[model samples]
Target chain A: MVPAADNQTRSENETKWQLGMLLSRPFFSIGRAVIRWINILGAATVFLFLALVKVFRSKQLSKIVQQLYYIGARSTTIIMLVSVFTGMVLGLQSYHALVKFGAQGAVGTLVALSLIRELGPVLTAIMITARAGSAITAEIGIQRISEQIDALHTMRIDPLRHIISPRVTAAIISFPILTTVFDLIGMIGGYISGVMLLGLNSGVYFHSIQANVEMKDISDGLIKAIVFAVIVATVCCYQGYFAHMRRDSHGAQAVGLATTSAVVISCVLILVSDYVVTSLLI
Target chain B: MNTPLIKFKDVTKSFGDRTVLERVNLEIYEGEVTTIIGLSGAGKSVLLKLIIGLLKPDEGTILLRGKPVSKMKKKEINAAFAQMSYMFQGNALFDSLTVYENIALPLLETTNLKKSEIDRRVMARIEQTELTDAVKKFPSELSGGMQKRAALARALITDPKIVLFDEPTTGQDPVRKNAILSMIAQYHRKFGFTAILVSHEIPDVYFISNRVLALYERTIVFQGTPEELEDFDHPFKDEVIHSLEALQKELTGLYSKRQFKVLNHAQMRRRAFGDTYCIAVFTLEDINSIIRYLGHDAVQEAIRRMGLYIDKHFGVIGGFSTRRNTNEIVTVLPYSDITEAENILKYFVKDFQGLEINDIWTGVRRRVAMAGPVEFTILAGIAQGQPIAEIDSVIDSAKSHQKEIWTATMRRRGEKI
Candidate 1:
């Protein structure tokens, strides 16, 4: 009987330990993830601080210009293509929706408001994040893995000052400009679709858009563009710079992983921060 | 004694639960070529990175001159770092930049020197390393040897006080390995800077070393001059020496004639550029009698075992051996002194007598295992400061005078003088 009691006590202890593990596992993982995020944020904050301080140097101007060419000037064709198609779709769909209620005249207001307040900035950011952002991650990740980053450090050059600052600054400057350009092309596409193709009054379309679209709406879109720029640049650079620190092997796979993660995380952060900023502004 | 240029005081480093280095203490004096020899994962590279502050040690302190690296301010550390350069094992030249740009980058980034001055320094380094033809080419366009030289040029362009090399001879062909070693040694002489080299290429690296530190099993197992390492008698040290010998030679435990060509070229290079070396040829005098008595299989086995023994014993003092025609073996011992050469001869005679041959074909070609001592004598001649082109004549001279030297040595051994 005493042995039975002892066995029962041992079984109870085992169950208690298992139960404790089950109960604590989620908390443990969450704590680990939170710590990882905190560290990433701290590194990114320091990088951003250093970048801002070094961005104004005369030597950085050429690099920033080079970045502008790579990020902005070269990206014009794709942005135009996507924005024009999106505007045409919005014009066609909103025409049908408004015409059913005999308010087809208000199609311009719907198209302009959607593009200015949301579609323009969101789509442009996604495109830039896919195009230039992944490239940045790959370039920097290769440098990190190849020991070029360490070479720079041994040379007594701050990689943050030389490599990261121009990139982040260029992204910041490029996003808002690209968004504005996208909005303008989109309006033109809307006019073409709603007036010439759909047989609506062109003057009424232009007049309604101009009358209803406020400067605040455009400003909000630009602000979102800038915020998205920060998110994408910070995420990409942070991922690339720390690529060697991860458990991934230093090869094509590691650089690919860094690029993919940078794009995914930046997209998620952009969307979430968009909501936060929109709510705060409202 | 001179003060240490760099000092590691009880340095301990670990990754997770795996300890790489445990309380390691070492010192590198100024103007000395200190080579750290170790197995692949023995934390030799990590120790180098620790000295340069690329990776910090878990515990203990590294001092540059007398200043503790960990305690220095950021600006001070950067300033201190500027005085040192590292040639990475992979020759980490920037993939995107031309060789000229890659070498010039450090000067451009760190110093306030004018472009003209930077260009002059970069060109001088390029010239020093014989990289004039590959200046505008990317690293991928250059050969492995050229890339290493380019990396070396880049490391030296800054005129650093100390240069650190990581596995400078790993993955290199014998000729290129000799060239790189000779180049580094020449530059080290030209500029009296402290050099710390980490390599797995033993005995050969000793040819260019003022001292050696052997890292084994999470700590430094031995530290001394090349001569001292030759006398070091530990199981691990023996294993390291034998492994290095095995690594350099072919399956028969003898280097090929091709490797001989490389070594001869290297010896000529050392003779041309800096140091003096001696080449000794040892011919087995009674091979026909031994073969008649023990058969062909037994003789071959004896020769193979003798190859291993010669490699182990003579290999200690940068003496590399290779088999010649059939009955002779030639070894190049990189020393200017006749005493060291004589010491090799003495040790070889003593150790060759003790080497036992076990397998034999005897009694109507039936395989029999016999453990017995073999009777043989070695006739050797020493030639010093000869070029590769002149080596054949010296070897021939050694062969023709073999009888006189043998008779004289035998008379002396018998006290018949």
Candidate 2:
């Protein structure tokens, strides 16, 4: 079979230019692309399981330890910083609003409720986007263009298994613990503000925080945070994975574009997801 | 053919009305280094992409180890890519990662290998490609040859069963070219992988890859052993051999003068001192086929198209255009040296060469001459410095010399003086 040489050339030319827009399009429907998304999701799930199997088979405790540090131990600073700031802001806003009705003491319970219900999870989501999201997106995007993804495929190793799954699982596991820490720190900020800044009783502040935040609220916030974590991680991985699909195959700019796009998308998605979770809970 | 490891059966792909690949069938056996050789835009790269599952065949099937590529998921298809290594013409290394990181990336992503194990394996590959010194540097920091080596290191890091080299010798100096070829040969030896190389570096690639597939006229015009290609005995084979000989002659005679023997009185102005003249055609590889393909019409079209493309893009062309005929235009550049003429010819000739025809029917091709995608190739030929006052014999000499080289089936190297 022979194709017309000129026609073949022309088609190749068109494909090269359209490559960017075509590759980028998956970002739009991939989440909602039902069958495609499900296929990818199911495969991703299987890939994760396979990786876990390999890890167990190989007895790779060191890799697991390194991942624990990368996902959990190293993220503490940003996590703590986000929670404290969210706490202080919640304290200041609640002070003015509750005091206007001569109910300034409710600031303790209000801060706890806000942090457990929304602020802790939402702030953690934003922080992780800046921290974990950027690292994962950039790393994978570099791999995508560098053909490391292709290299993995050559080695008969599903890149989704060792590369994407670990990060995704790490995010899911880490975000809840991170959100719990944020929730605890945020309440402490409320307690400090109430005791020192507002001259409220420390006993009352701590008691209010402890009683106001229930297991259900904590559980719900943790669940939402975990979901947001998965979204951010997966979106970044997807961006990086599909980066090579571009014909022009952007170099550094592609990585940057993907990371920025992932961040923006993840941030927006986190907010939308937050609303949905809050509504369902109420 | 012993149950080919890979086979392309009537595979055709089109983008809208323009077709990239058409019902193309090819069989690649295991353990053979098959080189696909062709000119730029000949769809060699597209073929590689199709086999790697980067693109799908719109018409037929690509079987790998008896499985269809079109039916595989990206992961499954991508899994096949694990069995292969592809070297891009651009040496598309990750700009952000250090060389070590680039080599270690596949292991980190795909294998359950520990960091130390990945590092150890990467170090071995780096050593294999002699990129240990460059391990810490990014792709930008390395020299062109070193970057190529690093890219090769990255490709071979995972020990793929098949490797694809895309214009591997392009942009490389002769030394670097040979080194890369031998490096590829070495990897092919150690891994026993089937190497599918895409390149125009025939003299170099022909040594390593036993089988050659020449993509000409959208068909496999030449597919055989190097001996078969040398003795191809077909008109097309003659063209290739003639081309190689001509190119070699062109390069070696760069500084040598061409003695022209003026035959008739009409060519009198071209000589000096007597009925003899001499001029050196330093660069012809870039412009010779072009002249043959389009004739004089191509030259004028090149000049005009160059002017238009320059206005649409960026480039400066100021010279004289001699209207030899309605279709043939010869420009005798003044004030500019021979090199400048080469540069000028490179830019304006594509439109004249019929290469730009694709741009008209399909809006997909990047006019790299305009897009800054690549710098244009430039070459120059120098005319003898004999004064026009005694020029008859000089014109005769130059003309005769040109005739001799043009008529000779093979290049005559030692006929000087």
Candidate 3:
């Protein structure tokens, strides 16, 4: 019963609407993802700020020390183990490349610089994220679901002060120290591969590291470590602390998901921040 | 009238699209035990959280002592919080901390008390909670009951004027559940603190509660004294309360009324045309007086003990029992005549009389001292019925023939019965 002109107009309008929806869907998805990430980042920043404000609460020293033992001291063995293998591989590869130009002596310089400037902080952070960071997330997630955090609130105790601040403080103290250990142990691992196994001059290896390494490089690496520590601690604690808010899961499953997300996000943030810090400092 | 201690005025709370509580209005008086009863997940805990400012309402106001909590300054909120304590549904004892450390944490964090004072208070609480042996153990290392006690000890350590208990006896056995309720009642009387309890321990909680708030369908459906609640007619009463009673029957190892009918039907199906059965109704006489002189807890214990004795004697003879009401147990002995039932009833009476039911009163006596000796009697009535007979009529006949078969005069601990 419709007129030709009216039918034509309706068809054209439908086509336009369909085309518009088709074109805007991707933008809509991208916008949604962007907004979600922004919300997460904003929430994490607030959580970190609140925790930092309560870092100096009464009797916080003991809690921080305990976290240091867990995040820094307990992780030392795994850090050392991974660092040795990584340094040995780096030594073997660099030796092979440098010996092509009769420049194998520079292997020491390359190993020391690479580990001190980049590998030490990045590898140490990733390893700790797998070890201590996941544990923190799971622990806090369990506390969240089990109402321990609510219990703390009812007791008039700030959970951020009691739980998160100590871990964050410990991370700030521990990361740089652990990174320094990684550098030292990794360089020794390079020595074992370059000098002891490949017959490079031991004196040349030590002298090259001594002569080429600068305080700026060490400080830059330490700066990266500190940044990585903050990112990892904040992301992990935020994930666990708000696990109960996750819509996709509940209870123990939520805890597990939070732990996984914490580790993944922490490692991503660590590497991404490392690059940014390195670019600024360089 | 005195002003309410905490009042919720047209409060509404929602999570995402789901509205948990809608325009909920309730008042809690000071120095009285108020219990919030409802179906699970009906926002009872949400109401408690609103009172304590753990969760803020999406609309309206929560007032503490006539002052709005949301409008209170930080110092005012802190002062208000200092007078309150909450025991969570799940005993949220910190797993990493030892019992002693857990109990001592609040004092250490909130107060500048001397170490000796903290130690004394912590040790006293631990001893009172009977956690002295488990003081060094972590929460994970303790039994479920022990963890609950530990959590209770922690909640009470601050000696707050207002205590919020969220299903405090959820995972306990009947005996332990009664003990915990008694403990709360005793403490409430001793400290004169306002106790706000969220519980599913029906009838038991009603005894200790001065006011009962029934949360149903996302609002406070009824709020009044326990006696008033009993008389208040609402779907919540038939749905939540009756369902809980049914659940209690299962928990207490007795059949519910419906279950008893099904069982009786099954018994009838197995019976021959000429075969007869006996129905006996055992009523704990003077229950109202027992509740008056002794207490609800004592009457409950007596009923439970009677049910157990009935089960023990009749269960082996292919008989089953159901709690007919608050003070009566109905037993169906299949394929047994009146004489046979009478003989079994005599043995039951003898065994029950010798059962030393006074042990159940020991804990109650410590709290409530009696002026004179109170005697408790159980009256039994038996009636013969054919398989085709109406169960109601037969039960009525048994009730009409009721006579005292056993009596016990509650005496002093060392006095002869």
Top candidate, metric TM-score? 3
Better structure of 1 and 2 per TM-score: 1
TM-score of each: 0.76, 0.61, 0.81
Candidates by lDDT, descending order: 3, 1, 2
For model 2, residues A1-282, the per-residue Cα lDDT tens digits are 566998889899999879977887887677567877587668645644554455433424455566667877788898888788778878888888888898887888999888888988898878888887888888888887776666455445556665776677677778888888998998878766666787877777777767776788888988899788777777777777776554444788888888887899889989998998889877
Q: Which lDDT tens digits does candidate 2 get at residues B1-417?
A: 589888888888777787866767788889999988766776898888777766677888999988887677878766677678777777777676799987787677567787888988998877666566788999899988777777787778778888888888788654355457666766776689999988765454666777888776555677787657755556655555446534532322211011112121234454344332223221223232332222222222333343233333222333222111111222233234345544554554444335553332122121111111211222323333333434334323323433111111111111111
Query: Candidate 3 chain B: worst 10 consecutive residues by lDDT?
Result: B363-372
For each of the candidates, give the backbone clash count.
0, 33, 0
lDDT of residue B58 for candidate 2:
80
**What are the runs in model 3 whose C-alpha is more than 4 Å off?**
B249-417
lDDT of 3 by residue, B23-113 (tens): 9999999999999999999998898888887999999899999999889999999999989999988889999899999999999998999
Indicate the residue-level lDDT of B415 in model 3: 31
lDDT, candidate 1, B1-417, per-residue tens: 776888888999998899999999898989999999888888999989898889999999998888898888988887888899999988888998899999998888777899999999999888767677899999999988789989999989888889999987777655456457756776787798889999765545666789999888888878889768766778766666667766766445667554565677776775654455666776667665554343333344445555666667778877787776445777777765556666767666655444321121122123112223345555777765445446667667556645312321111111212
User: Residue B254 CA error for candidate 3 (Å)?
Assistant: 9.9
Please give the C-alpha DockQ score of model 1: 0.54
lDDT for each of the candidates? 0.79, 0.64, 0.87
**TM-score, ranked from best to worst:** 3, 1, 2
lDDT of 1 by residue, A1-282 (tens): 568889999999999999999999999999999998898889889888888898876478888999999999999999999999888999999998999899999888888889989899989999999999999999999998888888787777778878899999999999999999899888888887899899999989999998999999999999999999998888999889988777856677889899999999988988899899899876
- Could you arrange the candidates by DockQ from highest to lowest? 3, 1, 2
